[model samples]
Target: MKHFGGNDRDDDVRLKLVETLYNQPTSLMMAVLTGAMGGITAAIATQNPVITAVGVALALTGIVRFVLYYRMHRNALDHDARKLERIFEAGAYAFAGLCGLLAALTIYLHPPGAIQVLTVSLSLVYGVGISARNAARPLIATGQLLLVCLPIAIAGLLAQDIVYAILSALLVLVFAAVVSVTLNLFRILRDQITAAEVSARMADNMRRLARTDVVTGLLNRAGLNHDLVELLMALPEERMLAMFWLDLDKFKEVNDTLGHPVGDRVLAEVAARLRAQAPDKAAVARFGGDEFIVVAEVGDRFESERLARAIAEDISRSIRIDQRRIDIATSMGVALLPNDGHDIDTLMQSADLALYHAKVGGRNQVCFFDTAMTRDLVRRKEIEVELRSAIQRDELSIFFQPIVDLETGRIRSFEALVRWFHPEKGELRPDEFIPVAEETGAIITLGNWITAQAAKACAQWPEDVTLAVNLSPMQLRAPGAALGILTALRDAGLAPHRLELEVTESLFLDDSADTVRFIDELSAEGVRFALDDFGTGYSSLHYVNKYPFKKIKVDRSFVSGPNAGRKSDAIIRAVAGMGSTLDMDIVAEGLETIEQVQAVKAAGCTLGQGYYFSRAVPDYLAAMLLAQERERDEKARRA
Candidate 1:
């Protein structure tokens, strides 16, 4: 087994043995008292001058041994442990040798009497004490035991009596047994220490792994919480901490388009960049997925803002992996301590709210939390709750705006727009609540209802006219979404060819093989798709060519804005030309005047839809308009 000191087993065992030997001051103190008392008693009992001098020498050796033990104990950590152990060994040997010499002198000078018995008994007692107390160093304990016992046994043997011979032989046997027992005790103590050290090291490693992120090797959410609590508690009163909540925009698109392995590499690179850009005192952590947090102490709001922006810029740079360049951006939200919040939970919530606003305002920017954002969050929550029951209350309705043919001036289709007539707020447009529904997963149900309603209403109109309904990205990507739309058309008795589904370019950002298969299935059933708000999103041209779109609608910004000069007209003409070449219809939206209508017609648009023709109306009004168109067509045919 490995040792915690990173040394061989024998070396570690030796170090531990030395440490154990010096730790017991009580044993050393007892040895000192025994030596002094023995010497005093021997000098008093034996009236020989040589015996008295030997006794004085023994007492001095005991004093020296006690002094060494005191120094080792006091400087145990600061001094070389091995050197201290050697010094201790020298002192023990000197004391044991002096005790033996004093006993030998007593046995020779005096006859079989009280003084001789007392000195020999004290020497044997010293042998027993070293065996137990110094067992950690077996060699040292054995040396001391033999030194104290052998002299008395030899002196007794030299007395030339059978009683002394028997006593000397018994002393040899006792010392042998003590040595064997001390060696066994040393082995057991060594094994126990080794096991304890291994267990402690393993536990420390497990704790470290538990708090680390496997993908990025950064502190995980649990680690962040653990460290953040300590940091907050120890925060200086003169300082303020800023919590930056960062989210990578379009990171899901990278995961969906490329694979998760590539996404992981990207995340790792992002983590490295964050570490490099963060302040020296900042604590960076990964909150799983594409979310990361950085907490740093700052002087004021301006410093925090500067750091957030700098980090965002660094993370937004293009990352190259596997010979492919992947570009991504990050949005950050900042919340300050003592102002935005005083605790971790409150600060995190405030920063997250600011992050939501950053994403909404447009990604790749930094936003700070304020009381107004909290109020807006409450309002959004209210909308989410009310919208859940809006359909059950029958408060939702569809309005149809006619799509007219530029050449024939005839209604070709009516695009269905959903409106919510809130009981207290009256009419609310799609923009006000559609985003909330999409976020809360209410769009799936809302889109299905609109599709079925629009299809049913179209079934009663002229056969040549088609119905167009918008599709949310969420609905299109939902499981079995194609089957649901087909079921709606069949139940309404509306032909699939008369249903046109309008989708935005944003739908393709997170496009997957399953979504493509679903679109193909619906297309096979004769449901046509139109690219809505084209040229307003990334990779519009790529999506237009990739998917089987039957129509492409020019974004309203290019139709009648003050900026719509030669450049806008050229773009419209170019799109119109491409659509004609591809055998697809081109529609120009948001025309509000005759001049705009004329401009699109001249630009070769096939269909037009805007307030210039008619605003979105109820089903009854739409039906009346269709009936009037049929009458005019009959009159023109007769002429």
Candidate 2:
């Protein structure tokens, strides 16, 4: 048994064996060699049977211990052969114990002779055996050398023979020094080998990271560019090629509604789907932020379009993330090579232009680039530039539409809608420039201006009248936007209760938590919120209940015609009923006819706003209507 760390039972057995052979190498070696010399000398002198017997036993013991240690050292070197290591460990301790016991018995029998040489030799052999089993190579080598010299020194000491002891000690010292030097050299070489392996592993890891996208695990742009360049070079000059730029229809909505963590998981699933269904010849890359570019090789331009359509449909199929099934629809734009251009830049430009057209034409569709698409692209670019200048010049106006109370038949409040007064294009509706403004991040500035202007107008209205301002989804994310409205109201000397900010269900998309928090913050400042265009989005009722909304404006699509859609009518009735129960205000929009107005009023909607009262009028006309309403109410009260 051998002790490791600090176990007593195993240590006692090992210590007892080591104690028996302490410094016994010299005695053992000399006992073997000098005993042979003694027997030879006795053959020359008087022959003695006892002298021959002692000589043979000493020589045999030294040879046996040497053979045992050598075999154990070889077994320790074979790492794959673990059974050999265990066997060697057992055999080594057994040999050491037997050698120690033999030495003790020999020393007891031959007390007057040079018996200490046998005892010291057994101790040294036991030390080497124990050291080898524990993987102490340097110690094992040192112990082996000590064992060889201990026998020679002990023999000379007992005989008082100085010349024999000196020669035996010299021989042992040379053998031990050689073994120690060899073991040290081997260890240095082993360390160098281990370091080389680690360096190779690190290099492989770095290379893998370079080629893979961190978010989607798809090939990154760099990897895609390299692969595409190679493919282009290999293809025939006449071979048709195209790049399909795929953008998720409403990826921003996904990121906003569910958390971004869920968004990332959806992107990962999307990457997997693309890889599984992508054309064999096509190479896919994430490009950046919910956009993917696939380079495909085809036989003709039509084939490329067909392939792009197929890819779009494949992506539109359902995907499950975190146990929730999500429908992923993509709008893809294909730009054909040779027809578009051979260069990646030209191909990308055309594809992007087509992608814009797809979004404009209504999302979840595929479009191919042509000369006609260029006009729309150039026009859009012109609009984008003009929009930036328009913001700086303040070429915008607010059109206030009245939200009339059904019971009073009087305007209770007005919703402020934005109108872009383009220098050359005249008055432009939000549909013309809203998307462009949002893309340019100009909506933040435009939205703040609208909030401030509406709040300022609130002070001029009658004490009982309130001013309602529409909020874009972009404005909700603007820092201090809610505070800006409160500040404007305070500066204008208007009551907070008389100011309402209208936000659509789209505001809750992707960023519901932030929207909820912002609503809570502003609601604390006594500003009220109205959910605009309700029932047109997913779970608007649930959000209305969760949020602090003062009013729910039922979507106009429900009130578009008399009994137009049964589901829409039912939805309007349910929302009005629920709002009444929750003590919330319900407004019906798009009431163009008396029947639609009467239907909504019968449905229990207290507020109605649309062309029935009037379209959004100029400020002067609106003020006249307000004055008229007040005069009529005063006359009725007197009567």
Candidate 3:
């Protein structure tokens, strides 16, 4: 997994090839002897310095043969045997051909009697030797040998002009063969170079795939570790690296709602955005799933915080998937190296703790590692671990929160919420354990419990009142979830119209077409759809116009105070007006103050729910509250 600094083995192979090119011997030893005789013959006839120099050069170059042969025994016996054998054979054949030509040229120059006989005899000997050495292709070797020896032999016999005949034939044959073989050698070398290049490219590609993630095309875990370790060691001592561990908030909702294919695409889109937004000094990696880690260089904790916030905000804005716009958010944990902790394990733990803190602080936020966060993370981890057994022990329960009818100031429906009665922690709110349940895939079982419990409570309600149950996006994605609801309603003897399901916009994100289709199917069967946290999401007016929803609940974010931000007020009014025009119900949630209630009522909303009505209570207490409202309404009518 570590980055390679130098590859000596591959380099050594190339160096060895260079050495082989400069030092290989020939099999044509007789040709070398013939070359020496030609030098002496040329010395007598062509006293011209150039001719004598060429003859002498051929004789002296024969020393290259002795040097190469001396080293041949030391080479590896098995390694590249054919390649090395071919090199030696090629050199030997070329040497024999050169010697035959020099002999012919020396005779052609017309040397004296002794020189003439010696030159003609040497030409014949070289020609015969070349033919013998090239036994595998004697026709080519014999033809070249005759081309050099025939004219020299004829002239030597006819006029005894050995130097003239030998020089003419040898010069012609040697130059011609040299040009032809040189061209062939050039082509062979080019082919070998091209093949080596192809091999190098293939190796590079294999290394790339091994160290990269196919989905994000970023460094995989192994690559990340190598890169981080290298960066840590190379960084300036005065500066430090900051790591941000980011987990996409509620990413499972996207998967459960839209399926894994859509989820995969979303993750890719997120990775692209991260790379684009990441600082020049940062490295981003998709650790796995919807979790990513970014390592950056910063001047101080504040600078790190600034970068984390920017990243979180940019990612949270919006992502369109399947032609539907999704509101995406990420919770990030920031850990500074050498400050939070130096070692990878400690740094990772602190960053993870910070991430857990961000999630607990209400996702879509950034939290830096601190002593307090570690304690909270440990406690939260313990709680998450314990939640696994809560369902098995029958410790999970549904608590009812009153949904009031605004016009009559009476409780019309009891909305079911979840709570965990831990053996050690006493009572735990949904916020504390709902996330844990969702993470562990325990929401499916917990959701069934909520649905069944709410249906049973509805059975105990007055025939006019309805029971509202919250459904997780994950639960809604479950196979046969709608059927499960139907079964619970039938078993509890609750009317279909009297059972209302409060689902967040995330519900639309799953099996969206099928989910929307299922919603339509169930609505046709008298089930009502309440869009919860309306203003907090990408509330497409098209969705309201398209789906058969009965209610649009303004999120608490928009209706929390009398002096709510203009944006919040505008969104609430727009939603309420849109719902009214569509003949859908509008419920304003989190109306703790009378002024907030009045604001919602003025906006044409008909229902409200918050601490003003009552915090979530036991189903029996919720029923009593509903009954008390009825009595109070009766008393008001008498007054």
lDDT of each: 0.86, 0.69, 0.72
Q: Output the number of the lDDT-best candidate.
A: 1
Show pairs that collide, candidate 1: none
How would you encode candidate 2's per-residue C-alpha lDDT over 1-639 as one tens digit per residue?
232212222322333223323224444344344433433343233233554454445445546654554454444333323343344344444434433333433333344344445444544544444343232223333444444345544554455466645745664675565555645543553344445545766887887778779999887888788777877887788787778888897787788889899889888878877777677867878988898888878889778867776777778888787778888899888888878876877887788888878877887889888888757576675677687677569887777899999997989898888888887878877887877778656787787877777767767888888888877788778767777777777887888888888887777668567777788888888888888888776654567767888898888878995556777777888989998998988999999999988889988898999998999976667788899998998999999
Q: lDDT by residue for model 1 over 1-639, one digit each (tens)?
A: 221232426555566667888888888888878887888788877767887887888888888888878887877777665686788888888888878878887876764488787888888888877887888777788888889888888887897878878888998898999988887777777678777777767998888888889999888998889878887987899999899999999898898889999999999999999899888867889998899999988988999988888898888888999899999899888899989997889898888888877876777889999887867675665677799899999999999999999999999999999999999979877987899889867899999999999999999998999999999989987778999999999999999999999999888887788769978999999999999998786745778778899999998889977688799999999999999999999999999999999999999999999999999999999999999999998999999
**Tens digits of per-residue lDDT for model 3, 413-446:** 8888888887777988778778777865678877
- For model 2 the local lDDT of residue 25 reads 46
Query: Could you give the C-alpha RMSD of every candidate to the true structure, in order shown?
Result: 12.2, 18.3, 16.8
Give the least accurate 10-residue stretch of model 1, judged by summed lDDT: 1-10
Residue 413 shift from truth in candidate 2, angstroms: 0.4
Comparing 1 and 2 on TM-score, the stronger one: 1
RMSD from true fold, candidate 3: 16.8
Clash tally, candidates in order? 0, 17, 24
How does each model score on TM-score?
A: 0.62, 0.45, 0.43
lDDT order, best first, reads 1, 3, 2
Off by over 4 Å in 1: 1-15, 47-80, 157-162, 165-168, 233-235, 375-437, 440-471, 477-639
Best by TM-score: 1
Tell how far residue 199 is off in model 1, in angstroms. 1.2
